[model samples]
Target: MAGVSRYLAQSIVGTLRQDPTLNPLATLRAWPNLPAEALKRLNQADLSLVDRALEQGGWIWEPTDYPDNLREMESPPLCLFGRGDASALSTPMVAIVGTRKASSYGLAVAEFFGKGLAEQGFIVLSGGALGIDAQAHKGALAAGGRTVAVMGTGPDVAYPAVHKGMFAQMEASGGARVSPFPFGTPSFPSNFPARNPLIAGLAQAVVLVEAPAQSGALQTVAAALDLGRDVFVVPGPITSPAFRGSHGLIRDGATLVEHPMQVVEALGGGMIQPLPPEEGDDLSETQQAILACLNGGPMLTEAIVRQTGLSAPLVLAELTMMELDGIVKKGRDGYQRGL
Candidate 1:
């Protein structure tokens, strides 16, 4: 199907905008690497359906409008479509993402950080899903700050239907709802999995408040890591399955921050920002040893005490506090790390 890859072809077209002498469609047809069969098919293709789809769309982003950070990706969306202020992309952005079925604790954290980040003047970016994503967008709006909702469906289409009013409010309030999909694209479940990275790619950093092991929010982490974006995780209750993936991120050496100011100051102030003492910054030597034991996998109390050469009473006490902090969990089989 490819004499030239879709990405390379799109990149060529995007760059061609700067050249007055070249026509984009003609350049595509003339390229020696463009497959002959593909060109023939495109020529034979009907234009009516394409015209119908464009009617459902809104403003289309010219190549010049693509954010530098996003354009740096191995593969970026060919074009962006949206309503309202696409100018929000020019500002620094921070993504706040989590499970759509977030718990009360997750929702509260998202709200707190969303408002806090926006108040600090960074645009809050998130996938426009319900639960944590919606709450974060609302919190930013409530603080009179700008936010961007990156949607899986078409930019002008509201997928949840319930949030149509909220989307309208966002558009009117200087924020935006945007998508990579065309104007008439459907909100099929498959569309969402690919949308998570757009949230991460647009932002300088990503903050994950909560997610289960299988949460699509984790997809952002993978993309962020690849893009060299720093990821910050908020610790949640170990008893809840909602935080399993979140805690896993923390254990994987992602920074664990308890407040939005930590992220704001860290990003804006760089090394000069003397962050206040947070729980994660003060791990005791005993706690370190205990974590080392559990890092391999779940183990019984006897195994932990034996492995660390610590008395049962001390190990038991440390485990109790760690469990309370949601750093670890105890199951019927053994004590292990938790969300």
Candidate 2:
């Protein structure tokens, strides 16, 4: 029986390798249940191939029996490839996913949630897509924490060519890239919806930063609810199409999240202390003056000079310090108080 299970697992993987769109669920469901299916799938592959490709890439298994909750679903994937530590999946995980074309506001939320979640020891799960997904992964990485990048493509295939560097960085940082797809599969639109389920399922809750009505991130929210996970939507400018979907989700009963700590509390971590706002709290006099100039909002260099009453060289030095302190935000427009 064990041998048969291994054969099935191997065959499924091999088939998917050649064509990821092959009905993996069909093949999986045929195997009595997910556990037996996973065992067979693994046995079908070369031991070395499985070892090398998935050593740290998590597992594809079914629970021994239908977990009552999961079994009640329409048709759960026969098996799933869990990257990183599965135990981490069971921990308080928050899925921070949003638009691939995100606004600065979206980026800020992703970073804030990533850092806050990591600091509180909760794992962050997200697709490894560019934009918001990348920002979320980066946020967690920047905080020296573990995150999981669930892939729509193969773990070995970095979907956006440019993110190869980011992908390598993620693996190097004790984070893991995961996918239900086998090695070397190119990304497909269909695969993304398939991948969304895992991202939503693995997390205790889902956080939508900025998603357009048609965005794939919203699909993740649907999956989260189906999996019985909590869903939180960050409200954004109602006028922005980027926020349309999130607002709709909120109207439909998704929780609203104004801060990362809200997500932390939702996951049972309770309220969190934001790293003390150090801008004014620990600033040198010079730094304070620069901030004072920018506090009115974005300012031109000349405007800053007039406001601070400081020489160009002096103002530049102070502004640099304030920038380094994260007290000021910089952009093409000019500098402003870091929101």
Query: lDDT: which candidate is best?
Result: 1
Locate the minimum summed-lDDT window of 10 residues in model 1: 270-279
Candidate 2 stretches with Cα past 4 Å from truth are 1-74, 82-87, 280-292, 295-339
What TM-score do all the candidates reach, one by one? 0.67, 0.68
Writing each residue's lDDT as its tens digit, candidate 2 over 1-339 gives: 123444555666577778877655565556455576345544553445445656656465454432343444454555555454544445556789999998766776777678768878877889988888888888788778778888987677778988888877777766767676665556666778877877776677888989999998988888888878889888888889889999999999999987778877877777855543566685667667777777667887677888777887666545643543357767887888875
- Compute the lDDT for candidate 2: 0.72
How much lDDT does candidate 1 score?
Answer: 0.80
Backbone-clash count (model 2): 11
Cα lDDT tens digits for candidate 1, 277-329: 34445667998788888877899999999999998877876775566446678
Residue 78, candidate 2: alpha-carbon lDDT: 58
Model 1 residue runs over 4 Å out of place are 1-57, 270-339
Clashing pairs in 1: 243-339, 244-339
